[model samples]
Target: MKTVVITGGAGFLGSHLCDLFIKKGHRVICLDNFLTGKKSNVAALERDRHFVLVEQDVSRPFRVAGSVHLILHFASPASPVDYYRYPLETMRVGSMGTHHALELARAKKAVFLMASTSEIYGDPLVHPQTEEYWGNVNPIGPRSVYDETKRFSEALTMAYRRAYLLDTKIVRIFNTYGPRMRIDDGRAIPNFIAQALKNKPLTIYGNGMQTRSFCYVSDLVEGIYRLSRSRYHDPVNLGNPREMTLKELIVFIRTMTNSKSKIVYKPLPKDDPKQRQPDISRARVLLKWQPRVAVEEGLPTTIAWFRDRI
Candidate 1:
């Protein structure tokens, strides 16, 4: 069986990935500092002999024992609230943490995968962002901590692939929501869901006309798994192409939860993307993948999970 090392393995996306690898009959070594990641996310896996959870800050150099077939660098503060609170830590993980992860992959001769985000296409000038888009990001904005660091990580990954001939792949993930997302994640999906569940006002920034494409976490992880197994060395967009607005999202959530949460308008956050969508043509042709779960199919499951937690 293949041995996989996943940094940030206790976080939302990382924990899901850890479960996927284990279910596929692989040995998984999960490393996380729990800075923003909670131990409870992976608590269920503690009993499995094949799953190893290590408390580690990957921004600092670390070593792993034995052979590793794949290294998935997913360690970083993902949400705006988390990054704004821990900017230095976020930058360190994307820079130094990524460097360490790449070095480990090089030493182990393992295929490396960097978990990138569509935020690299900040306030995207392109309607449906493709890998070719250079993006329109503010280098010194509040969101720069998360956006630029990911851009840097992608560059570093490509450098390793070019200079050291490392087998590396990058996936530019779009908006993804599913179980295990923190209640105060500070993202649209989690924020709206939490508010609606509590019968509180659902706040919308700006006019709520800003658009985003949501991909179910299961579909996103499935695409990621396919990319990890492939030989592609460039960034591929992996998200649903279907687009929706924040207002519409709130309406749907309110209906699903049968709540009376009123819509409240707020000023838009600076540098927030006006439109967000993915051009997944590359993923379709290369990975032979497309999101199977529609918003209708995915949202109910997510809402139900939140209901239980609340």
Candidate 2:
């Protein structure tokens, strides 16, 4: 069996990936510092003999004990709220953390996969963001900490691939929601679901016209796995292509939870993308992957998960 090392393996996305790799009978070494990640997300895997948890900050220089067949660098504060609060830390993880992860991959001759985000396409000028779009991000904005760091990480990953001939891949993840998301992570999905469940006002920023495409965690994880095994060295967008407005999502959540919460309007955060959607043509042709979960199906599942937590 292969031995895989996943940085940030205790966070929402990382934990799910750890489970995926372990289920396939591979030995998994999970690394995290708990800066934004929680140990509970990965608590279930602690009992497994093949699963190993290493409390580490990827931004710092560190080492894994043995040979690693794959290195998935997913260590970073993901949400806007988290990144804004920990700007310097976020930048360090993306830049230095990615450097260390690449170094490890190089030493082990392992396939390195970097988890990027669609936020790189900030305030996207294009309707449906394709892999070719260079993106329209403000370098000094509040959101730049997360956006530019990911951009830097992608460039760094590509540099290693070109200079050292490392086996490397990058996947640009879009909005993903699932069971383990923190209640206060401050993403719209969790915010909306929590408010609906508690019968609190569902807040909407900027008239709620801003759009986003949601992909279930399972589908995103599947796409990541496929891209890791593929020969493609460039970045691939992995997210559901179906788009919906924020207001529409709130309405759906309210109805699903059977809540009486009223809609409340608030100013949109600066640099929030007016429109966001992924053009997955490359993923389909290269990885033979497309998201199978529809919002209609995915939303209810998420609501149910949050219901229990709330």
Candidate 3:
């Protein structure tokens, strides 16, 4: 069995990757600093023979005794609240941390897979952002701190692939949601869920017309897995292509949670994308992957996880 090391493995997506690797009969090593991640996410897997959890930051060079066949570099502050709260940390993880992971991958002679985001295509002028489209990103904006870092990360990944002949896979993930997402994380879906659960008004920005395509975490994880195992070296977009307005999403969440919360409009945040939908034609053709979990089916599953009012 191959040994897989997943940095930031105690997080929402990282923990899920850990579970997937362990379930596949591989020796899994999970590393995290616990800045935004929780221990409970990986607590259940602590006792498993195939699972090993390491509480450490990836910005610093890390090592393991045995050879790791694969490394999933997922360390970063992904959410708005997180980036706003820890901008410097986000920059460090995306820049230095990604470099450190690359170094480790070289040491272990493993395939390096990065969990990049669709935010690289900031406030996209392109209708459906594709892997080939050069993004329209602002360097001075607040979102630049995260967006630019990811862009640099991708650049470096490509450089490593050519310079070092490293096997690298980069997947540009879209807005993914599911259970284990912290209620206070301050993303749209979780924010709506938390507000509805508290019987409070759901917040919508700029008249709630802005649109984003949400991919279920399970579907995203599956796509990432497929890309990592495939020969696709360029970044692949893995997300649901179904677009929905913020207002429509809030309404759907209300129905799913059976909440009586009214909608409240707020000033839009800095550099919030007006439209975002991934063009997954590449993923479909190369990886044979398409998101199957529609928003309708995903909402109830997520609601059930948070139904007890945490």
Give Cα-based local distance difference scores for all models.
Answer: 0.95, 0.94, 0.91
lDDT of 1 at 94: 99
Q: Give the per-residue Cα lDDT of candidate 1 at 273.
A: 92
Runs with alpha carbons beyond 4 Å of true place in candidate 2: none
Q: How would you encode candidate 3's per-residue C-alpha lDDT over 180-230 as one tens digit per residue?
A: 888889999999998998899999989899999999999988888888899
Better of 1 and 2 by lDDT: 1
Pairs clashing in candidate 2? none
Measured against the true structure, the TM-scores of the candidates, in listed sequence, are 0.99, 0.99, 0.98
Q: Write the per-residue lDDT of candidate 1 for residues 92-204, one digit (tens) a residue.
A: 99999999999999999999999999999999888899899999999999999999999999999999999999999999999999999998879899999999999999999
lDDT of 2 by residue, 98-193 (tens): 999999999999999999999999999987999999999999999999999999999999999999999999999999998899989999999999
**Per-model tally of clashing residue pairs:** 0, 0, 0
Query: Best by lDDT, which number?
Result: 1
Task: Write down the worst ten-residue block by lDDT for model 1.
Answer: 181-190
**How much is the lDDT of residue 250 in candidate 2?**
94
C-alpha displacement of 276 in model 3, angstroms?
0.3
